[model samples]
Target: MNGNIRKNIRIGATVDVVLKKDQPTGRLTRGQVARILTGSATHPHGIKVQLQSGQVGRVKVIVEEAPSE
Candidate 1:
């Protein structure tokens, strides 16, 4: 799933993100989303999120979204 749309992203979704510092390297880190930082419905790059692992970055790909309650 595309991670650029905030609507498609859920709180507990697993996603691949590129940390701010790693943006130059274009490295992707995988983790479960802890909190969404992007307030917009859509972003040109991607929605920013904080991972459960304490990493903050913009989501690049949606690995697996959390199941709906």
Candidate 2:
């Protein structure tokens, strides 16, 4: 299951960061999923996504490409 998910993921997929507390005030920026760090000693649930601009932050929100009908 894990391997399948990793294979399906797009390394250069676009992502946006939204603060969990403040939704409106926090603006979203363009980023890509650098690596999938999950189920580790530090992060138990969420994934850590790194941006192109060298800004690393936790994945607060993830917006995948919507399916085209």
Candidate 3:
């Protein structure tokens, strides 16, 4: 699903995001979410998050939800 909504994303979820430098090219980086950075419930651009790989960006696509423990 799309990644504009904060509720749709979760910590540890795998997702595709656009880094600030890659926004112009619309490049997407795939990684597991480490932490959510967006405070609001929604964002026009998408919720900001930090990836497990230490990459910070706005989510563009929700690839896979982290398995519930």
Candidate 4:
């Protein structure tokens, strides 16, 4: 699933994101989501979130979407 939708990302969901500094390089960092930072339903650049690894970045792709509640 795509990461553009905020609803697709859950607190414990695993996703791939591009760190602020890595956007130009398209570097993808994989980790479980720690928190959802974006309040919007969707974002053109994908939702921004804090990873379990304490890394904050905009989601690039959702490796594994959290199950719907």
Q: Identify the leading candidate in terms of lDDT.
A: 3
Q: Which residue pairs clash in candidate 1? A: none
- How big is the positional error of residue 59 in model 2, measured in Å on the Cα after superposition? 0.7
lDDT per residue (tens digit) for residues 45-68 in model 4: 989999999999999888886776
Model 1 lDDT tens row, 33-54: 9999999999988999999999
Q: Please give each candidate's TM-score.
A: 0.94, 0.43, 0.97, 0.91
What would the per-residue lDDT of candidate 2 be over residues 1-69, giving only the tens digit for each residue? 111233333456566644344445765565766655444434432355556666654554456742335
Local distance difference test, each candidate = 0.94, 0.49, 0.96, 0.91
lDDT, candidate 2, residue 3?
19
Query: What's the best-to-worst order under lDDT?
Result: 3, 1, 4, 2
- Candidates ranked, most accurate by TM-score first: 3, 1, 4, 2
- Tens digit of per-residue lDDT, candidate 3, span 1-69: 889999999999999999999999999999999999999999999999999999999999999998899
Clashes in predicted model 4: 0
Better of 2 and 4 by lDDT: 4
| Model 4 TM-score on a 0 to 1 scale | 0.91
Quote the lDDT for 34 in model 2: 62
Give candidate 4 misplaced runs (Cα > 4 Å): 67-69
